[model samples]
Target: MASNDNDNSLIAGALFLVAGGIVGAGVALLFAPQSGTKTRKDICRFARKARRSAEDAVEVVEDFKDNLSDIVEEVGERATEILETGKDMAYGAKKKLLKALEESGEQLEKQRAKLSKLVG
Candidate 1:
């Protein structure tokens, strides 16, 4: 979710930058004492640069998304492995506890029988 938020923020920031650049360019053109031909050329050049920048931003996002996916998958796999290892350890511990309890009960039974004969 945090990654998603960051992605959204990056996209929003890129869009804002592009929008601001275009607006600034337009204002500059309007205030400058340039002919129509020069202004048109300038606008065209700025548009091309903007398009490239937008494309670069998209590529950046794509790479980030791909890297995030790879990281998520790796973490998921590690979590699964850790869970399985914990289960195996728990099972081993349980078996040991049960064996110890059985041995203890048998010893108690033997001691009780021995005491009963002596008491009788």
Candidate 2:
């Protein structure tokens, strides 16, 4: 659980870094001297790139979330299966023990009857 939290934190940090870098680059471009038309075009290009990068990051995050959910569900199913199997095995063992006990009791009763007949 701690590891999962760490992984999530790392992903968040990486996304933040990418966003910060894009913002910093845009700010730097704004300060640089250039013709008005060229500057506007550059800013527009940078904005578009940043938007695309953000969208990609969001998609990656969504994919990670989906995969993690699937893994959790799979683990839950496996655990349930293991529990049920254990229960079944225990029940089977109990039944076998009971059958053995009944047979032993019957045998002892037969032996006692035979001994009484001989004594008589």
Using all chains and alpha carbons, the TM-scores for the candidates as numbered come to: 0.77, 0.70
lDDT of 1 by residue, 1-120 (tens): 887888888888888888798889888987889899999898889889988988898789779888988999999999999999999999999999999999999999999999999998
Error of 2 at 10 (Å): 8.1
Q: Write the per-residue lDDT of candidate 2 for residues 1-120, one digit (tens) a residue.
A: 885796688678868978897889878888889887887899889888888887788788778878888998999999999999999999999999999999999999999999999998
Error of 2 at 20 (Å): 1.2
lDDT of 2: 0.87
In model 1, where do residues sit more than 4 Å from their true spots? 1-13
